[model samples]
Target: MKILLRPVGLTFFFLATHLLQSQASAPGGSNLLFYGVAALALIIFFFIVVSVADNFMVIESKQMGIKDSSTMGLFPNIREFFRGKKPGYLDTAHVYTLTKGYDIPMAGAPQDVIREPNVTRFAVTPPDYFGLRPIPKMLVEEGDVVKAGDPLFFDKNMPRIKFVAPVSGEVIGINRGLKRSISEVVILADKEQVSRTYTLPGREASREELVEFLLESGVWPAIRQRPYNRVADPDIEPRDIFVSTFDTAPLAPDLKLALRGRMDVFQAGIDVLRRLTPGLVYLGLDGRGEKDSPYSVTRGVEKRYFRGAHPAGNVGTQIHHIHPCGRGENTVWTLGVEDVLLFGELFQNGRFDTSRLVALSGDSFSEPCYVRTYAGANIGELIAGENVREHSRIISGDVLSGTKKSTDNYLSYFDNQITAIEEGDHAEVFGWLIPNSAKASVSPTVPVLSNDLHLTTRTNGEKRAFVVNNDYEQVLPMDIYMTQLMKSIIVNDLESMEGLGIYELVPEDVALCEFACVSKQPLQQLLRQGHDTMIAQG
Candidate 1:
């Protein structure tokens, strides 16, 4: 079935790609090469053949795995180009078998150096954001004094996974709403910012002891399961664990810059993590470096270097290439680099410090920079005094997958970016209807957008019926049929959803599909709804 659609996906993309590569001032300059009648006939015929073929396709058997190396993987890809390729990385010969996912045109990457800040008051958000509805059980009440590394709350569903306080302070408030579930726990810090240390059983601590300490210190939330993309259940042992060392998202925080001078602690965190799983702890890092970036050099774990675009840095993508998660299988657990640093700090020096550097970016600001702050810090602090144009948006993460927020809101617990972008609310005479060669786009049907462009909330087009054209297959490197999965999702077929490898996806993985959909469907939202339904039932 894929062999039938492969040419449609590859050919259509090549047609638009050449326009980007052309040095002409405009996509066809004055001649309008792509607009010629001959081109129009071919375009219409191409879509007709694909749309007709896709309409009759159906999958009766359930199967999930990486697209055979001879074929495409998640984000069916290209050797597009790597501007930041380091020596010894990205060998042209075997790249086809090695990498997946191509970097698309995007703007607003933070280039600022990381710094530390002293936070007066710190807060911790509930773990429910990941869609893990942990029944909130508060361990402390308002005005109660507590030390750093102390427990603030625990999941009622899984009491062993505790939310730890980051600094010594008084519990200022237990912000709960509706069903009396805890929403936020605010701590008014003591002037000295003290932390209580633990006398460990030593470096030779057993796996069970390590797991217990992580839970006691409130670091258990860092280990998240994949089948559900939620906080891992400490009770169920995982088959393997993954840690992503690079940030390939547009304007992603530089791991090498962020982890500077923290290698010892990072390594210690790796050792600590090793104790929690009897399975291998896979660390994904950037292979584009001539010499191994400090982020990739660690001991006691399997190090896999990824050499491709955006989602390449995503642990989910890496997991697919390494070990595909299938329905009813114990999910592969993934941890972030920051989570490991803190987890190690709890055991290394017994001091808890959540303060770290955050990247501020987007075209709305005059310049992009990094600010030192703690998790859940006030969002206002990061954007103060910036040239925030009228109708500008402040996002808590990257533009592709981040949540928009008012400066008044607190940052999310796992966020490391504060993006300020202009809202694209104003309309154009015939926006996206005519050729605008100056614009950047990956679609052959739309105006050609510059390779580097700023995006907004503009839908650009209206929602329409799901088209069976092979456009989505071009962007996703996964093995499942893009159209079949969409068909299953629209009708809410849980069995088909599972068969389509829904367990191996998150919104970030399909965000490009949302951007490229010709029908302007809220693809990410659909994918989110589809997964949420499955997880709620899983």
Candidate 2:
């Protein structure tokens, strides 16, 4: 229709102009009424032809799976024209500048200096990974000496995915929790550390071979899939893979500091990840950093820049904006920056090197700094002699989403930071009624005098009515309606939950919302429940 209209419209238009010209040139004066009517008809016909052509082009582009960015109708797309543009510092990378989300300012950010902590104990906990069946089958007994990369256990449901030791050591203890479920597989590190090596895959190795290598070597658990936030399935291919190069949670370790002098290894890791997925591997970089950030130069992945407060650095946020995982079979894998480095080290040295930079941070520590330690290093040893307060609460990971740990416990398997904060056991006189300026808050009721506020374990208020307000929306940068979604989860409305975009979320993604919630609702736990319900229903 468009092709047919173009030529016919042009011929009629030219003929009309000629007739008008010929009439005006005749001996009789030009017919003013006829000329006016003819001009109006020509203008209307021209617009109709263009509108029809535009619609046809849009339809054809949709049929061919091409995105049409041009203006539709007779005018421009005002919304796109007024939409926020990418910051000048993003360079050529795709940019997602989020305006929502809050940054919880607190004291005890880790210093840049990296110290060698005398960490002699490390453990691999099975509970860290979601969707794992209770009590994974053990591969080693206590008192067995093993090298790094030696398999310690495997999920009984998926026995191929092995959990390996972080250091060459003696299996000192196989700790158990309630119902005799395996909690921690503790290993006492040796003075002389050794690692087990395996044959590297060939240059032309297939994706299945790479998956098998990762599974067998125990690095596959680092690659987690969305929709359940569990370890990526070995049999299923992800639509895409995502890695956030920076951490934005409160007191989170600076990944740039961790990325220093490891660009080659990181690139190697990217190469390995690329082969596993037929889709592109996406790298999310901090938009506030320099143009020459090592992550920006990384090849074999799609680079995207994110600038915002807390959740912007989250890979879930990046995935939601870039390519969200839909319901059902749609899945996307996500890995932390250190996880990628692990893969790089595996391929580079043909062994699993669990060496990581752990940040010791919080107000309780006398000197908060970065420490070089193995994965699952003892939290007590990591923070030994750093305590300044008489009573402090130790947490493995960032203050927001980290697990509470004690001096006797080891670090969480996936965490790279240990935080120590004051234990808020003492009760305050009318604490809720009295607005303390020293306390940090997202609400306007409390006056926050400074950026850094000393936080504690105390929930300022008890659970109240789940009020429908912008509080959760203020901190959650994603498009999903957090309040309604939580309500859906509470009511167990599976259809409504799915429609509210529950698949795109993980607990950490909503940690900020939980912090900002005026009702003091446990949003992360609720989201986890929603995920479990969806998985069970499927």
* Top-lDDT candidate index: 2
Q: How much is 254 displaced in model 1, in angstroms?
A: 1.1
> Would you estimate the TM-scores of all the predictions?
0.79, 0.84
Per-model CA lDDT versus the true structure:
0.70, 0.84
Q: What is the C-alpha RMSD of each candidate to the true structure, in Å?
A: 10.8, 9.1
Q: What TM-score does prediction 1 earn?
A: 0.79
Q: Which run of 10 residues does model 1 get worst, by summed lDDT?
A: 58-67
Write candidate 1's Cα lDDT for 1-538 as tens digits: 3444568666766765575346245654546544543465677677667555443332211123222342332222333243444455434322213344545555666665544444566678784357645447778889999987788877667778877886788888777656866667888778777777776757777777767777776677877787767788777777888998887776677877668788888888888877777788988878765766686568999766666666778787788777677554456788888888887677677777776678887767676778876667767655664566678888887777788888656677777888887787897888866766645455666554465577666767788887778667766667767677777888999889888888888777777667668788777788878878886776
* Residue 514 CA displacement from its true place in model 2, Å: 0.5
Off by over 4 Å in 1: 1-86, 89-104, 115-119, 177-181, 289-291, 327-330, 444-451
Clashes of each: 15, 0
Off by over 4 Å in 2: 1-88
Report the Cα lDDT for candidate 1: 0.70
